[model samples]
Target: MPSPFRHTTPPEPASAAGPVRAVYTQLARDFGITRAPTFVVLSSVPEIMASAWALMRESLIAGDGGRTGKELAALGVSEANRCPFCVDAHKMLLHATGDHALAERVARGEQPADEDQARVLAWGRATRIPGAPELTPYPFPAAHAPAYIGTALAFHFINRVVSALLTERLLPGNVQRFRAVRSLGGRSLSRTVRRHPAPGAGLTLLDGAGLALLDHAGPGPDWARATTVGPAYAALRAAAGEGERLLDADDRILVRETLGAWDGAHPPLAWDGLPGRDRPGARLALLAALAPYRITEEDVAAWRTPDRTDAALVRLVAYGAFAAVDRIESALPVRTAKEAS
Candidate 1:
């Protein structure tokens, strides 16, 4: 099969070494898929790839929460981000949870008949709105907040990278649109979806990478403290922050100020304050942060000189995506210890 990757050489499982190989091995074992386009697109940068996998593994696959609820949250977040690939993947995972009827409802864009589940899905979608009331009094239990919120956040980053870097086709010919294919894909992953590996397993994959960033993550959000989520989130934050180096000091400030004030609404094409193609780096970074789906071939060609490797391009996009991550992180509800507990 042709690689889904466009801008870089895909990592080889057979020859991958150290952390890269370890992540691939664990992803296969824990995620139950041989070719995850989502993770492999990131394999060009080992730390970023591992950090992303760790965040997803610890929070969504291994963290505390019902798989059904987490999967719904993931699906909702994907929808909010306009990531068709992740949306399909999560809907299929919902099928793997043996709730095919509800998966069908979500695939059809219908609200779940169960009101609580509907609210859960709504809460997930509302996440992109930043500071929206739907985020507070979280639809799920407080104790499960880390898993639910972490899962939402993990996808918030993943969806951006996926949307910007890869095509929307989850499968060749985009056959995932067919119900039978989605169910089959879901069935293949059922066992893994059914099993929640112990938390902190993904932390090992970070090894050298996450330790330095531990202090940077601070105590984590009030909702996710005392859990494995903090380290993974920090590790990813640091990894993606490397991309900031791609932009100049002035451009960096511009991107940050723009994203910081964003109200979580998607902007229209040709909106003001966006850098022109003349400043391809700033333009690409902002688009990746705000509306990655709008990135066009010319936008990339303008930035990709023969001297620039795929790794550099990936980091640039990660910088933009992480800016959005930072913006959303600030607006997230902050509860005190007593309230969190």
Candidate 2:
């Protein structure tokens, strides 16, 4: 007998043209299905994202060098979030970017080959297991430290935003969208936020970046907050870009002091005498306190561990904390005349 999954008649196109119609058209074209695509109708958010994809593309490019870093970051975050859709999407993106080996490893939940890839993968794993705060550090040779730290920090922010987007179900073409295109580096979570309606309508709440979004539901609040962390993130990025030359005796002191504070606040959630809702805030405060020392990639590189699992998780948290600090620092105004100009 013929297979039960044999080709079936296609669905009729919608009489009225809309976002769904457009998606249907695109899906049909992509999948080579003459019939309409089976995806559920999406809201205006996806359409908005499609229209403003360029801006989002620019944001990701500006944040990282290109799709490779962005994809690595996305994969790390997806792994952290435990979102199957995101994992699939990021894996596809990685493959498309000629990172076939890394893509295969990520699919198997195995560690990446290089420190940068490994660090990102670790970040993703850590995001899943929140109880093990000690798992945030990376395990790599000292020479690879700065790159690992910078990449880890970048991936942390990427993971936060992507997780929020996935949580909100704002991804284009629904959950399977990432499978078709692979690379989300061309997209921005900011655009996703601007395009979609806030989950709770007008409820304002704190996000990872310490900013508030009007619609504070799902991942919206988190991404909204992350947007506000731009300044601190930029500062860290600047320092990382400058490489080892940026470090000094004062920088070392700052790093040590900040690391000490982080050690004290390592498991901010585990601290006794804290309210339930206040845990995340407390963690954020602890992270903010470490901002001063996280000025360079070298500072971040110093946070690695030897054990694979523990190293991965620790690196993830460290990355998030570092990104938060970078965004905060970047927002500050430059007092010097040259900077102001």
Question: Who wins the TM-score comparison?
Answer: 1
Q: Residues 1-341, candidate 1, lDDT per residue (tens digit)?
A: 76676556766667777777778888889999855888888888888888889889988998887999999999988999999989989988998998999998999989999998999998889889888988877788788888887898899999999999888888999898899998988888899889878898778877664334455545455567778887888888898999988888988889988987899999987589888888889998998888988888898888888777888888898888888887887788857322766
Off by over 4 Å in 2: 1-56, 61-63, 124-341
| lDDT value, candidate 2, whole model | 0.35
* Global lDDT scores for all candidate models: 0.85, 0.35
Poorest lDDT segment (10 consecutive residues) of candidate 1: 209-218
Question: Each prediction's TM-score against the native?
Answer: 0.95, 0.33
lDDT of 2 by residue, 1-341 (tens): 22111012122354424433554443343322322111221112222112112112223332223445555655665454344544665666566556556666666667777876666455434432333442334333332222223343444443332332223233443443443344343232223212222221111111221222212222211222333223323333332222222234444344435434432222333544322232332232233233212122333234323442322322333334444434422332212211211
Evaluate residue 209 in candidate 1 and report its C-alpha lDDT on the 0 to 100 scale: 41
